[model samples]
Target chain A: MTVILNQSFTGVSIGAVLLLIALGLTLTFGQMGVINMAHGEFIMAGAYTTYVLQKPIGDAGVSLLLALPVAFLVAGSMGALLEWLLIRRLYTRPLDTLLVTWGVSLMLQQLARDIFGAPNVQTTAPGLLTGSVSVAGVNLATSRLFILGFALLCVAGLAAILRTTPLGRRIRAVVQNRDLAEVSGIATGRVDRTTFFIGSGLAGMAGVALTLIGPIGPTTGTNYIVDAFLVVVVGGIGRLRGAVITAFVLGLLQSVLEYSTTVSVAKVVVLVGIVAFLQWRPQGLYTVRTRSLV
Target chain B: MTTTSTPPTAAPATEPPAGPPETPFLGRFLGRFRTPAAFLLGAVLLVGVAPLVLSDFRLGLLAKYLCYGIVAVGVSLAWGRGGLLVLGQGVFFGLGGYAMAMHLKLADAAATGETLPDFMLLYGTEGGLPWWWQPFANPAFALAMTVVLPMAVAALLGALVFRRRVKGAYFAILSQALAAALAIWLVGQQATTGGTNGLTGFQGFFGYDLNDPINQRMVYVVIAVALLLLMAAARQLFVSRYGELLIAVRDSEERVRFLGYNPANVKLVAYVVAAGMAGLAGALFVPAVGIISPALIGIVPSIGFVIGAAVGGRASLVGAVLGAIAVAWAQSTLSDAWPAGWTYLQGLLFVVAVGFLPGGLASLRTVLRRRRTSSDRVGATKGVTT
Candidate 1:
């Protein structure tokens, strides 16, 4: 019973990290209809931001706190720039977006390698977050608990903003119908840029959280990319609530499966499961009814 | 059947599947001649002229490139003509390659009178050859399996995917995931598949010495001939009514469905054909390149196949072949010069191609011609007015 509880905790923590990453992916894909393959790089940028700040600040906790916002700003600006330069022209061509963004992804990965060096960089966990808490024979690490909280906080904040803000309203309007939104006096382009910024910023925040779990590297983003994409896809395109639910389900499932089989086999099983799931629910967990929208 | 055998000057008996009806008999004749003429010329250069000019070593490199060209041609058909954007040719390529490689290993074992291949002895729990590797002992069976395996896999996969009406990004992601899954699976099964440092140490291919210079040259000749033959087959598909149907499916699948034609079947045929070609390419690649591994059959390499066709212009057969060879040649040359820089260049080229040069190198001529014609018109008008 303790082992199962511990496993479930582990699953929840893993699910938190996936939720953070998939949130950004869900927003970008849902709103813009653009598959940004460079998204993983944005996450990498955030993690690297944390790495860079750790040295100068000389306090792990303080640096981590500073790194989150800095990472968001840096990744967000880069996302907006890419959106303005390359993505704007390819809105009608989703497949072309895949190819172009893939190119962008490769370039960004090389850039990371050049800047950070090829070797993985380790970041120390904050002093307060290093220890574990035991309850009923289950030892839970503080860092995992913090990550789980952080993920919830971010999701809540995003939900609140979307629910209450005029910007969120504009974003929703544009997403529903760009032409209609334009006629109603909203600048769809600004909304697109803003959404991309927020989405990439969230990816950056996920990166900072990622460092709490493991070492940071140029290829770190790639490690989570396929899983994150699957999360967004399975959750349903353009549905934040669905993204949250799917992420936890996938993450927990993988965590449990890893205990029984080799990691590679577990991954294969998960992938096959997802493929089967897709066969059953092609539109995913949530589908928006639209007229003649292919 | 005789129509296909007729002289280049002969008017085609079969009506061209596409193009305007006003296209004259002479235009149709030229259209028919164009592909075969190009094929003959390319065949002559590859089979006849190349051996004379290139050294044995260079010819060997060209043979490896021709294998890439073979895959690229299929990519062009599936992506360019069919608009399927298949990002997992590596799955089929690996299928073909492993089939041939297993056969070679089995045949080597039989000749030596050994119970199992060397890898099995080195890595397996039991010393005997696995049951799956048993049929590959026959050279004929191995060859057939190379072609049949990919086709069957593609047919099954295509039926599932297309029947579900899963197109666009979902299809691309699923296909890429398959490549990734296959690679991981292959890497995990070291005992059976020779994981990581994949299947090598072959002495001969059907009694031809791999190390002998003459036999190496013969291998190149065979591949060059195969390339020409495959291109001919692709060209036949391109001009056929089926090709028109594929284009229709690409443009608007729903409209095709409404017209009472099954878009899924059309897509399935192109997908299967592409997979078969990729498989054959892999079979040839194993002998020429002397190795096959998970690294060659992963998501990255699958994308690599599409990149070659994209660079050459996916719609043009010659372009696909040329693009594949050019990209392969460029990678070798660039890597020799700067080991770490080629990927950056490749990425940049991919971005530029997708963004600005959507039609690839094949479209450059038309762009230039349009500019020249406009300039000439301006010149002629200025002179008349003056």
Candidate 2:
């Protein structure tokens, strides 16, 4: 029972990270109708940003806090720039966007490889997060708990922004009906730019958060992009809450299965299950309204 | 619809003028060499003669291209006409490749008088094949499974997604994620699936020696013939009622649905057919290349398959085959010349292709034809005046 609990906890912790990475992807893919294949690269940008700032801050806690905004800004600006330069042309052409972003992703990966030298960067846990706490006879990593809390906070904060802010309203308007919103003078283009910024910024934040539990590498983004995409798809397009829930479900399933059998077997079982589930519910667990006839 | 309504009201658009009395035979002969026909002929001839002209090393390269071409044909059907953007053909390819590899490995073990392969021993497995792998030991069963498994998966996935009306980027991402997950799982399972190194070091296929020059040339011939058969099949489908329906569904699914056709069924047929082709390609790839690995079927290669199809003109059957072979050939040559620089060259090609030439190499003929016809008209008009 204790072993199960520990595995479940570990699963939830990993799930939290998956949720963070996927949140931005879901928004871009689901709401904005842009398949940003380079979203993972944005997360890498954030991780590198955090890594670069670790020394200047003098402590892990301060460094993380400082890194968050810095990472977001760096990634966000890049996202906006990408939107202005490339994504804007691919508005209604999703497949073209997939190809173009894939190209951008490769370019970014190569750039990172050149700069970072293909080695995993060491990220130190803060003094407050370094230790472990015993809960129900299971030793739980404190950093994981902090990450869970931080992820929840981010979800709440993002939800609040979407629900309350004027920019959020414009984004929602643009998402629902681009032509109608444009006719009403909503500046759909500007909304696209800002939304991309926020989405990419979130990815960057995810990268920084991932550093607490894992090593940062140029290709680290590639490792999580697939899982994050799965979470978004399984949860449902344009559904933020669905993404979070699905991430936890998959993460927990993976952890428990890995503990019982082997990691590889667990992955295959989970994937097969997910593929079957998708076959049954193609729109996923939650459905969202969109302009697409499909 | 609005564009369709517009007629040629502005002028007769550069009319053809009188020329010297034309020889019907010459005109007919020249017409036979027109772009599309010439391109088709060139491709067929190249694949046919390549084995004869090239060394053993080059034949191996051509064999790999043929595998890529097979996958591209499927991509053309799914993404080009069906508008499905299936980024997970790699999963099917891997499935077929691995199945064939398992059978070959098991066959080798039996011949060597070992109960299990060397890798199994290294991994601390008892000298016996796994239960799931047992079926593959039968050559006929392995071949059947190689094609059937991927098609079944595609059918199931298509039925679910198409029925629910999940098309476009959402479907693409889902399929891509599936490929990624499968690759990861395969890489992790060193005992069952050959880990990252994948299944290599094969001695023979069935009883025939793989090292024989005649056999290698025969493999190339088989690949070329298979490619031709696939193209013919694709062409037949393209000109059929089903093909028209598929295009109709792609252009306007609601209208097709209103016309009493199930768009889902239409899309599903193409999807499943594409999967089968990819599986067949994979099965052939295992013996031709002597390996099947996670690296070959990962996210990158999946995208690579699509890029080739897209750049070759996804809607064109010949384009898909040629484009795939061309890109694969380029990659091999470039990588051999400058491994570090090949990726950058690929990126450049992609950007140029997407940004400037949306229809790819296939459309170049259309452009040239237009220019030639216009020039012919100009020459005829000048001749008449003179």
Candidate 3:
């Protein structure tokens, strides 16, 4: 029973990480229909930001906390730059955008390798995160609990921004109908850059959380990119509620399967499951009804 | 059929399927002489000139390039003309490669009077040859399995994906996921699949000694011939009526559906054929390179395949084939000089090709021609078009 409870908690924690990683992708891919393969690199950038900041700052927890917003700005600016430079030119061609972004991803990975060297880097978390706090006889690691709480906080913050703010309203307007939004005097281009920024910033934040758990390297982002994309895909294009639900479901499914099977087998099964599931619900968990035809 | 045999290279390698619905003036002017001319050029370069000019080691390298070129031919058909960005070709290549490697390993073990391959012994021959590896012992069965397995997987996957009308970027992501999954699974199966190092170290291919220069040359010739045959087949597909239907589907699927045709089936054929080609390449790659590892059949390698096709012009048969060879050749040479440089260069090439030169090197002529003809409009189209 303890094992089951622990495993379930593990599943939820995994879901939170997955959600954190995928939130940016969901926003960018959903809003612009641009597949930013470099989003993973943004996560890597966030992680590296954490690592870099730990050098000068004596307080591990202070640097870690400070790293979140700093990582966001760094990754967001990079994303905005990408949107302005390359992605904006290929807006009419989504397939081209994918390839170009993949190219960008490769360069960014190389850049990271050159800067950080090929070896994996890790940052020290404050004692607050590193230590475990027992609850309900589960004895959960505080790092994981921190990650889960942070993920929820980010999601809540995103929801508030999207639902309440004028920029959020503008983003939603552009997402629904770009031409209409443009005619209504909304600067779709600026919105796209902002959306990319926030989305990529979230990925960076996810990266910082990742440093608490494990070592990170140039290729770290590549490892999670596909999984994040899968989460976004299953969550259905741009719907946050759907992304939230799908992340947990996928996380739980992967966790339960991993308990019984090997990690590789678990992954393969999950992939096959996603493929099969997509066949049934090609649009994913949720989709906005529209009369618009491509 | 004869009409379809017109030199596709002369025609810019796009549109009209079997025969141009309206033969562009360039194709018409080049029509009669160009087909035979192109065929003669291929024959002379590959069969006559290459063998005489290049040494055995260089020839072997060229053979490896040709193997990649074979995969690129299929990528062109599916991605270029059909507009199906197939990003996960590595899965099929891996499938074919492992199939061949299994047979080679088994053959080596049998020759040495061992019950299992060396890796099996190292990892654990405990369960005796897993039931799956048992059949690959037969040479013919292994060869057939190489092409068949990848094609079968592609057919299944393509059917599922295309039928539901899931395409564009979504399809690319799903395909990439398959490559990642397969790589992870292979890595985990340390005992059965040879794990990370993958299946390597072959003494012989069929009965020929791998170390013998003569036999090595034979392998190169086989790869070259195989690539040519496949390129011809792809060209045939491009000119066939079905090719036109594929382009139609790509350009406007709804219209194709309205015309009482299943867009899924058209896509399935190209995808399956492309998989078969990659599988063959993987099989041949085992003999030429003496290795088939997860590293070579992962997301990066899959992207490498598409990058080659993109560089050459996915829509052009000849261009894709040449592009794959050029990219492979560049990797072998450039990486040796500067290990880190190749990755950046490759990315740069991919971005430039996809963003600026979507039609690839094959379309350069068209772009230049258009620029000259419309000279009055200065700097128009920035000297290119999608």
Best by lDDT: 3
- Contacts from the true interface found in each model, as a fraction, amount to 0.35, 0.39, 0.57
Model 1 TM-score, all chains together: 0.92
List pairs with backbone clashes in candidate 2: none
Clashing pairs in 1: none
lDDT of 2 by residue, A1-294 (tens): 998899999899989989999888877776566778889999999999888899777788899999999999999998999889888865546677778887888878878877877789888878988899998899989989988988888888888888799987887676666678889999878888888999999999988888888888878888888888889778986667899899999889989998998887787788778767877787778865554545
Measured on C-alpha atoms, candidate 2 has an lDDT of 0.80
10 residues in a row with least lDDT, candidate 1 chain B:
B1-10
Best by DockQ: 3
lDDT of 2 by residue, B1-386 (tens): 11111111211111123233675887867765664686578566756667668999888888889889998989888877777788999999998888888888888888898877667877887646789988888999998988999999899878877787777766787788778878888888788777998898877788877889788777777777787778768878887899888877776778889889998899999999999999989988988998999999988999899888778877777787889899999998888998657777676666656544555677666545655776777453431100
lDDT of 3 by residue, B189-284 (tens): 999999999999999889988989889888888888888788777778888899899888777777788899998999999999999999999999
DockQ for all candidate structures vs. native: 0.36, 0.29, 0.50
Give the poorly placed runs of model 3, Cα more than 4 Å off.
B1-31, B372-375, B378-385
Instruction: Write the candidate numbers in order of decreasing TM-score.
Output: 3, 1, 2
Estimate TM-scores for all models.
0.92, 0.89, 0.95
**Residue A49 lDDT in candidate 3:** 98
**Which stretches of candidate 1 lie above 4 Å from their native place?**
B1-32, B369-386
**lDDT tens string, model 1, A175-233?**
66667888999988899999999999999999999999889898899888878888877
